[model samples]
Target: MNISAIDLTIFVFYCLLIMFVGLFVSRTKKGTEKDSKDYFLAGRGLAWWAIGASIIASNISAEQFVGMSGSGYAIGLAMATYEWIAALGLIIVAKFFIPIFLEKKIFTMPQFLEERFDKRVKTVMAIFWLAVFIFINLTSILYLGALTIEKIMGFPMIFGIIGLAIFAGIYSIYGGLKAVALTDVIQVIFLVGGGLITTYIALNLLGEGDGAIQGFSNLYTKTQDKFHLILDKSHPGYKDLPGISVIIGGLWVANLYYWGCNQYIIQRALAAKSVEEAQKGMIFAGFIKLFIPLLVVIPGIAAFALEAPLSKSDEAYPWLLSNLLPVGVKGVAFAALTAAIVSSLASMMNSISTIFTLDIYKPYLRKKANETELVRTGRWASFVSLIIAIAIAPLLSGLDQAFQYIQEFTGFISPGALSIFLAGFFYKRATANGALLAAIGSFVFSGLLKYIQPELPWMDRMGIVFIFCCLTIVISALIEKKGVSEKSINITFDLFKTTKSFNIAACIIIIILAAFYTIWW
Candidate 1:
């Protein structure tokens, strides 16, 4: 809990670097969207590389740097399921969802639902998703950020949380999505670099212990139940992860909904300069995810070997950094860790502003608003959300199983949303009725599986619900008459130009990250 002078210097330098990057981006950012398209969707011209970097920055937060690593300490390799399984969804999104969203020129995922289904369905989904996004994202972020702050300077969790919110709000409100994207590129670099250093340091520390094979073997033996590839029905540890069945079957639906249909994550890709850039961004992120276990999970295993127990599991990652990282490098590591959290908060705040402005405000209240006015409104929205989130930060302080719970609770909407999107594209017969039905159906089923029969194989049960939801959509769509016409939609077709070079780089990175595990571990 005691942060040395070394830690303070490292954290401060990192903060200055992030502030520099955020300020630099704000200087050239143009507020003239010309319309909702430019301001909200970044003129539908985002290149794949920027989009890919943004994706990495958006998804890899303290959640990975802290929560995932903490999970690694407690539960071992089962935690890898979070990143590894997501590759399946990322591929589906790039291949299918991208083309559809581009064709629709849609600004929000809810818009696609409205186009494919109805306003009623879209509204239901939008409200649910927005609430889920605000709640889950902020809850996990606040806990992680607060812990990171606590690790640095004790006392005043409230002050620390507000400080982070204010800093995040600054870039998000002024620069909009561009600010978030630009900052993300820098944060991802620091995050990756910081994670690698910490991991390498841990690996060296492990080497000092019994030796690599003996050290890992000893760590594995103690944490064996946690590391087992298979899920145990009665294990108290996996309370956060879906049952094995969920991992195998239902998790795909959740990941697809998130990476593919979720407005917050996908909006970055939509901002790409072109389709190639967007694709490159996505494939690039896939590669980064491949390395997460090495940097995040394995370090947890190492921390366990060090018997580095903390009052909160989330503290494990930070504790490792505090103990293992040397003086000069520690500052960089702390900054990178904090940057990961800041990037995530900034990204979510910006995306929420876009949805509220374009999806909610423009559509209902200010339909005739000009680009400048809308941009101004977006700034206000971001600022307001920040204030609101800051106020709620203290209330979010007591989350148990924080990371796992965030993912689990969000499952209510994620699976349903995933089903709706998949149903929209693959099944021409999918009707508004079916779309509406699938959302309700998946919600009910996933909930019952999660809460009612607590002992049921949740992962598998959730997967079954997904299959049933798919069936319901297919059957209901077939029975209906009037359906959506893709022609009437003004979706952003030809959005991102897929990139071969980026894709190749992405693949090589994934291979390299995986090789890190196979060879080193």
Candidate 2:
């Protein structure tokens, strides 16, 4: 992992560029008192391109680069269903989910729940989101990022985690969503560009100087057995992904929860100038997502072909970069990895701050807080959240299959949350009581199933729990005498109108998805 002078120079320049973009975005045109919108939602001024790039950059992090690549090493191309399915999920969110969220002009997902259901529902959801973001999402990203840095640069795990926290919090705490979104554009450039370069180099090496095309051919020739997109139940990795269910069942639950319900990811779209801009931006993100597997997963497959001696699958990507990438390129690849980790860290920190200040602190602690005070609270919240994440990150050491760890643990809540949101959006009869029951009941049931049905795949378990949640809510709503009222009507079907551009882009994405599934099936 010895970087040459050229490699170190490239890495330093990338760091400086990120710092410059983040700082520049944070500075206001004049010394004016910042409002909540300016700090939390980017003043609702983000355009389609900025929204698109920020969505992808915020979504792509050490999870995709480190955890996903590790899964690719173990499970091969089958692991790519997460990325490909997510592309479809983004399109679905744009067409069906974003319209209502934007029309409501809400800052957090829990806020929408409160409007649609009750204060109880909003408080329950907001608390749940805050805990998961702090304990799970933030902690996981920092751990994976630290793990990657430790492997690549030989930095100690604690130092790596703290350094990433400081780097991310520096700009994000001051600038908030605007800074995060604008700087994310540059982060995406470094991440995607550097990722592509690493994949190209790895493929070129695999091809023995023939070129990337030949290298790809060599990759398939060497590891054709690893190319299955669907796995049978007998396959060792089938329980993790579970074959056609990926297309028709629980994977959709996972994707919808992530793309549609997740606050940090959807916050970018919510900040768009218009619903049309938001839809188009999400579609753009979908298109970008289609290529993520190529950038992150392909390198792992190449690593397998090169037969690098790694102790674990998660080490595959770092091993490939350290062993195969030339001196100058290694620095670029390292920058790309750092870019992915730090940008995601920044995004999550901002989201945690947004949720705490708006959903929890404003409503509970200081109901009459002014705009300036709200912004200040958000900054403090971001800093405090980062400190907690940095403290917990190192405890994730020695966790095997870190990607699966995240997905499985998150499932406990995703099934219930997804059920409540879908029912609230589509079913007028879905009552507050029912929504609360769905949230609490489904989480408890999902957790119980982990022990009761230990043999079932997590995807299958999620699907089953979701069905129960929907049933519980529907039954409870039927039993209750209260009818749907105007007070709870924040969403309208009329808001789901689409542009010609959206339709055309969606059709193209569906066609591509169908072609991939068909070819691989």
Candidate 3:
């Protein structure tokens, strides 16, 4: 891969601009200092646009660029169900979930658990989340980002891993969520602009001097087998996608857990200026999610159509960037890839610190710690977590498909966590004991099912495990003989009402998704 001087200059300028914006926005008055609220929640002052941009920036990372592209190459358009279903999930979160979280003033997911259940449940889940974030989420992001650097830049993996950690840490550790969120606005601009450029180039190449539209037409003609939205049982990829289960089954568990309940993703909305702003931000994100597959997935399918000379599926994205793009455009596309990687790393680091400092350290280790002390502890936690992830990241090499690996591993926790939250919100009889049991049972049942039914698809396993978790909560509550716990949240119709504009936007999103599935199916 040959780099032009102009490309290098553009990449360097983009990096410098992001750092400057991050530091500039986070700078406070000369006499005042940042407290826990300012540092962790962006001073509770993020606007709708900032919230929307931050959510997409944080969510679309190396995983989508490198990992999901790999899945697209192997599994084709069926892989896009994750992105399409998530658009609907965001709407559900905005309409039903955000209001309760805002009304409760919830700063972290574990904090919500503490209020709804008990400290014991909160502590257990917080520790579980800490382990998952550091080991699975952070490590995978670092590994995939490093994979991209190694593939595109021809650098060694260790250099890429350490370099990205230092880059994300420079501003994110000191400036906190404020810096991370504000800088993401710029990152999204580069991300979308550069991503579209790469896709356009790939399409034009496929069309052989015809425009992108003709390129897509050629693609459909050549690889129509790769464009199905649903994979039937006979399909080679059915074990991963599992036919219609993608629509009416376990994918819902995955989407709701990731979009509505995950700490890092939901943290953006939680920091909004008001619940209205948060809801609007979520809807904005939903609209953006509608076309994300174009930026990430299509390039891989194009590579597959061209019969790219690749050793493995994960290399499809890097191969496209390296072989397809012209001189100056490569830098912009590279920066877009880097933007996705670093933003996600920064967001994950901030979230790891938030969970550890607030839910774990503040409650048990440092009950008397002041606000400044808590903020200091958070910064240290972020640094330490990054170091741990860097050390463990290289172990993820040789994975056939990194995106599927992440989804399957994270599924271990999503079922129980979603069950607990839904129970707390609607089922008044749910008790703290039941929440704890559901949390523990999620892992136990998933493991047992995997061992007992080794051939079952992971998606169906997740759906089955989710049902077991729901029953675990219910049975535990019935055994206790408590009618309704004192901590149960009182549900009201007013909590979920949406404005006319939001309703219209929601209808539009649903109609568009329906059209896509109908055409693809």
The TM-scores, one per candidate, come to 0.88, 0.98, 0.99
> lDDT for model 2, on a 0 to 1 scale?
0.89
TM-score order of candidates, top first: 3, 2, 1
- The models' CA-based lDDT, in order, is 0.72, 0.89, 0.93
lDDT of 3 by residue, 1-521 (tens): 45678888888988899888888887989988899999999988999999999999999998999988888899899988999999999999999999999999888999999999999899989988999899999999999999988888888999999999999999999999999999999999889999999999999988888799899999989889989999988888898999899999999999999999999899998899998999999999999999899988888899999899989899999898888888889999999999999999999999999999999999889999999899999999999999999999999997978899899989999999999999999999999999999999999999999999989999999999999999999999889999988988889999899999999999999999999999998
lDDT of 3 at 429: 94
Per residue, candidate 2 scores C-alpha lDDT tens digits across 342-374 of 889899988998989988999999999999899
Q: What is the lDDT of residue 197 in candidate 2?
A: 94
Error of 2 at 25 (Å): 1.5
Best by lDDT: 3
Cα distance off (Å), candidate 1, residue 489: 9.8
The residue-by-residue lDDT of candidate 1 on 340-457, one tens digit each, is 8888888887777777776788878988988788888888877777776777667755654467767767777776787777777666667777878888887788877767777655
What are the candidates' C-alpha RMSDs?
3.7, 1.3, 0.8
